[model samples]
Target: MAQITVVQITCGQCGHKFVLNTSTWPSTIQCPYCQEEMSQDMIPRVKEAWGTASDLNMDFARYHADRNETKFSVDLIAEQVHFPHE
Candidate 1:
């Protein structure tokens, strides 16, 4: 099974941080806070965010798995695709 992760995006317009899904990559994305359309230039930002999310997820899973005596499921419970939060 594939591990699900979150991508944090800083809106160019509103400058607010929001969570994005990895599957929504390489597409037209908008900032929920300001409705700013993410241009091609923002691809790099998304990529960086995805990398950070991946690293965090991996670290969290590893930490739990190490401490748990039983099998640890790292599978994430997915929420809405585009959720804007602090």
Candidate 2:
């Protein structure tokens, strides 16, 4: 049997978690708990209190992206995180 996993997601606007069954992990989803949508902003430094795949700080990536000498693979942050209205 294939092991199923629960992806803990929280809504940035309402701070709601959605743990449900699906075909696969979605890039994004609306929170059924609060009828709010979630995104990377709602995602904490830690994905689920344990830890996230992303670094605690994206300074390194930002620094690289800012540098003109090296070609940055990642896009530099341009906008601030603005949660959806509840």
Candidate 3:
């Protein structure tokens, strides 16, 4: 509700667990599980993110032009159903 916290650290060799930072995202993070180093080259970097979704601004023109059509399927597919409310 207030802010988003994400883990940036992951195992470089095994691609295992992650240790994220609360306030910031690192460029190169070492994996805590495998002790392997991961960097900007290894993983993709994001300029701006709408939560877990990445590559938001990558296709701005195409998406913006077809925004209307994209909205229908996007909204339908994005729906979440929680009957018991977790």
lDDT of 1 by residue, 18-74 (tens): 776676565777888888887788678768756766777777777767875443433
Each prediction's TM-score against the native?
0.45, 0.31, 0.35
Ranking by TM-score: 1, 3, 2
Evaluate residue 79 in candidate 1 and report its C-alpha lDDT on the 0 to 100 scale. 44
List runs of model 3 lying over 4 Å from the truth. Answer: 1-12, 42-86
What number of clashing residue pairs does each candidate have, in the order they appear? 0, 0, 3
Q: Across residues 15-86, which tens digit of lDDT does each residue of candidate 3 receive?
A: 565545634556666666766765566444432332333233334434656773352111102233788858
Cα lDDT, all candidates: 0.67, 0.46, 0.44
- Residue 10 in candidate 3, Cα distance off native in Å: 5.5
In the range 1-86, model 2's lDDT, one tens digit per residue, is: 32223445555677655563443434555787666655566444324432222232244455555763342232222245778983
Which is better, 1 or 3, measured by lDDT? 1
The C-alpha local distance difference test score for the whole of candidate 1 amounts to: 0.67
Task: Kindly indicate the candidate among 2 and 3 with the higher TM-score.
Answer: 3
lDDT of model 1 at position 83: 57
Is 1 or 2 the stronger prediction by lDDT?
A: 1
The TM-score obtained by model 3 is: 0.35
